[model samples]
Target: MASIHIPTLMLALLSGFAMLGVQLWAAQRSRLRYLDLAVWTWGSWTLLAGFAMLTARVVVPVWVSALLGNGLIALGIVFYNEAIHRHVLGRALPRWMWWSAPTVAWALTAWMLTWPLAVRTSAISLVFALLLCPAILVLLGPGWRGESSLRAVGLTLVAAAASLLLRSVHALTNPEEYRDLMQSSLGQGLTFLFSFICLIGAGFGFVLANFERIARRMEEMASTDGLTGCLNRMTADALLRHELERGRREGTPLAFVLLDLDHFKDVNDCHGHHAGDDALRAFAAEVRARLRASDVVGRWGGEEFGLVLPATDGPGAARLVEQIREAVATLRLCDGDGHDFTLTVSAGIAVAEPGGQLTADQLFMRADRALYRAKDGGRNNVQLHDSGWELGMESPAA
Candidate 1:
């Protein structure tokens, strides 16, 4: 039986810790709790400390290595379990369980110090396996279903736990053949090697998961309005064009509703620009609440918004826009001094001509004309686009 290479295992633990530490710092600086990267970082550090002390057994007393070193390793496993429970299970592990598990692990390990070498080895292995059980169950549980990354991480942890369990089983079944851990049989050597490899693999899997989340958030921020949390102008334009093409092909009606806040300049003058910003957000929220989920709204520009409503005619769009206008009229906004004031919105509706060759730009122009009519007639009403309404005519139809 070949002896387990203690130095080699310690070096692997050290290297893994170094890499994970750098990644933890990067995650911290980014202000992202995207994954359980912070928890994993702490686990790695504790595991590194345990392995370092064990490797220096000559300088560190035997009892210290047997008690404190093993306790640190157990704490590291508990941390890893917590990370899995939170990120993979999508829920937090109980606080009592987190503290109690480590207390029990340390107490049991210390008590076993007086036992025979083989008994101590078996006890330690069993304790570590028990420590990993919670994380393993969560990974295989229903919460983790359909997640490939979680499955990969779960499988690696399972293998590491199995290795520990097998080492314990081997020690108990073949007590005569059991030797010192650093000078042991094939089973002991494989256990250490597999555990080291699994730890490194889990670290990489967690880091990759966080990076994927960051990428998704970046894409969303780019396409969404930062202030109103609605679709931005560019994203809205593209989506509206796509909906227009689909409606044209399917012979369904599509309508574009353009809304402009009436006398927005007055609000900014009375209160501060901060109040004006609050008014804009309040208006967008009311529009969203009054419309259906399928209705798409975007911040067209300052004091203006646009909506693309599928399968709707001019009258239908006008009714929806009218509801939103009434809702906005009821909205009360607060100024810096806590005074409240109501605001009104003007809307223009342009329904797509079924099976016509009209482009999105032409649709927008017609809607803009209707919006001008609404502004001209009275600054707080909805206007549907009239075919006879001319863009440059002074008295456009309302």
Candidate 2:
């Protein structure tokens, strides 16, 4: 039996485990947690099983290490597909194709452990390497949008597999010289470097992401209303201007909704300012829940709020704002004593064509006109800034 290279194995194991950690972190981003976590979990399991295969010296045939390593490698690929399904691939592996990856693992494991490992048996290892090639292509496939981390991962895996394949060929071509302590370690060290060292560097992407997420969240808070948890007038207007440019360039539909809490001063006058604050908070929460994820909501200041809905037409904008209006009416916020008071908000919606001539200021002016109409007509309704209504209204246009 070949003795394990203690240092090389230790290094490989550590790097592999570190990569497993990153995989776990990356996996958490998936809306479906288990599907992604399974990849990292299986990867760690493969490493553990590989270690066990190395340590249990007396348990199996001479080539048992190769079989165990290859089997776990194949299992890792199966889970790799799962990760790709949720993350890099942007689609789920089909039921049949998904199951086949596993079926491949099970069958390949049996073959590796039992086969005599003559040149004929080594064919199985070749098959696993081939699978990585296609998996690499899909996992990191090229994009019109340019390169991605998945593509980088695909490149790394492809090169690593190539190194492994070459080393295998080298060993087969010259078995005697490749069988020594120094020789074995050198071959394995190169393989380990190929398989994992480049990826260890890539792990920094996770750290970068973590820091970026933290910074983004902090920036969001700085520009947001603490009580309502929406962007403040300053921030929202800044964002709207940016989006207005995008709307013009992309030729996509955009809508603006300007809203105000009706009789908000009276809520403060009647129930106290604390109640008004609660209403604002409740209003923000309701608006947030009602808007599509693509929609942006912000506190326009002093019981006034605003939204920008991209890729939505006028009708869609109206329906959504009306839904928000109705939802705000039904939402019962409480005072400190836990008394429920139903609140109603008025909304004004304005939409523009893609690359529309309207500036952000123009859009806000239109929406504000609609909002004023809603207020004048009686609150708790959504009004659109049709041709006649657009000329007059308050603007939080910034």
Candidate 3:
């Protein structure tokens, strides 16, 4: 096997990590100010510091290089694991978990000072492997199974862990060959090479993961109402058109409902805008809870919401709307001044039977007209289009 200069490899890794750390720091300062990115940046820099200390092992005191150097390396791995955990699960790891492995690794490194050099090396390698395990579990967890970037990050961590474990075993079996830290042995070369590659892969993988998260958030912001967390008007219109076409092709019925909160302006005027906003969010949640997975709901405008129910007939739509109205009536809300209040919703339902030739606009208009009738018929009622001006069953005042 060929010899590889360990010092040169360390230098290369040091420079690479420094650059990666700087780039990540810059990204965190940019529009992508994610907590994970900040944590990853710190991890890279810590790794850089550890590598720098290790590279200067020939000049620094033995304890500094072996104890502080290895300790920093283990700490850096912990940071990386924490960053992945936060990014994948949107939460921090336990405090004990954060400090436990690194502290043990550092203490073990000190305890092995008088032991064989290879044994010390093996202990540190195992520590690195231990630190990476949690990140791998989090990245491959079921919650993020569909995220390709996270999968890539997880696989990279797997490779790094495998390499570390292999190094630990090799050091134990070939202590003579791993006697010195700066030796020109193939094992040392391969270990550092693996470290270099894994470093680059992990850094890029984290960046990709951050981008994926940002993209998903942007898409959500575009498609959903920020206040109510319901589909926005434009997205709702597009979905309605698509669902209508699907219903026509499949010979299925579809229902469109327009709902408005009764006296919503009075809620704002009497309580405040904050109270009004709370009521809107509560009404949206109630409607969403009553809907099937296949149903779609959107915020049409202030105090108004739209619902699209596929494969639903007039009676089914009317029943669901009535249920939503009753649910709204039961919501106990409070104003900024701690005064309690209640709310009511009026809904208008328009159903398109199988093979009906109703355009999206026409269907929306019919639902809108029905909604107005519900509002005009003394409020807090459900009205169905084509039901011959029959006033819907009016619920008592909230």
Candidate 4:
């Protein structure tokens, strides 16, 4: 068997880990604050330190090389596992879990110092395999099913665990072939090579995963209103057009509603724009609470919102809007001066019945006209538009 240069592989791995650690540190500093990236950066540096100690086992004290080195490596794996847990589930493991694996591995390695080289190697390899198992489970779990980068990291962990397991079994069954840590052997060489590959794969996978998260967040921010947490005007318009097309194809009823807060300018003038913002946010929340998940609500510019209701008729849409109006009236808000106040909303609804050929503009115009009627009838009321040019009775203002 061709002897693999163990020292040379260790040096290369140390260098690789150092570079990966630096990149991760830079990413954590420059990009969005991700808890997982910070944890992984620490893990990379910890692993680098452990590898450095292991590489110098020839000159270092046996206790330092065997106990501290192995302990750090196990701790580093724990950090990696914790990072995966935080990234996927958005929570950290228990405090005890952070120290349990490293403590146990350190104690066991210390006790096994008097044992043969093969026995010590087998024991440590098993410890590494155990340390990596949780990370594998987290990355490959059902929660992250469609994340390809996470899956890649998961697969790399699986391979690393399998390699560690193989090394453990190989050392135990073929003790004479693994006499020394620095000796050139096929088993040691393959194990180290696999470790190196796993490090590179896992690091790259994490970076890609962070990028994916950032991109998704950017898309959401672009489509969402910053203050009210509703869909922005442009996204709402696009959604209305798409729903209109779908409703026409399926012959389903669709309702478009225009809602505006009554006397909104007075609130801003009386309580300042900050209070006005609070009212808008509260109104949006109440409206969202009363809406179905399939319903679409968007901030249609200042103090005005648009709703797209699928499979809703004229009467159903009116009832839902009335409920939203009552809910808004019950909201007790305080201004900057600690003065209590309430708000009312006026809504106008236009329904397109099945098989109707109403264009988006025409539907919007009808709804807009109905809204003006509601405002004119009273400050707070619900009005519906029908094909016969009939309007629903206005609800009394609270």
Better of 3 and 4 by lDDT: 4
Of candidates 4 and 2, the better by TM-score: 4
Query: What is candidate 2's TM-score against the reference?
Result: 0.50
TM-score of 4: 0.86
Clashing pairs in model 1?
none
Residue-level lDDT of model 1, residues 95-194, one tens digit each, is 8877776677678768876777678778888888888889889877853573467777878888888888887887788776455545545666676678
Q: Which runs in model 3 stand beyond 4 Å of their true positions?
A: 97-99, 387-398
lDDT of 3 by residue, 170-246 (tens): 89998987888888888877975795569668888898888887989999999999999999999999999999999
The order by descending lDDT is: 4, 3, 1, 2
Evaluated against the true structure, the overall lDDT of model 1 is 0.80
TM-score-wise, the better of 2 and 3 is 3
All-Cα superposition RMSD per candidate: 3.9, 9.6, 3.2, 3.5
Clashes of each: 0, 0, 0, 0
lDDT comparing candidate 2 with the true structure: 0.65
lDDT of 4 by residue, 228-341 (tens): 999999999899988999998988999999999999999999999999999999999999998898999999999999999998988889889999988998999999999988
Determine the backbone clash count of candidate 2: 0
Error of 3 at 204 (Å): 1.2
Between candidates 1 and 4, the one scoring higher on lDDT is 4
Candidate 2 residue 132 Cα shift, in angstroms, is: 2.4
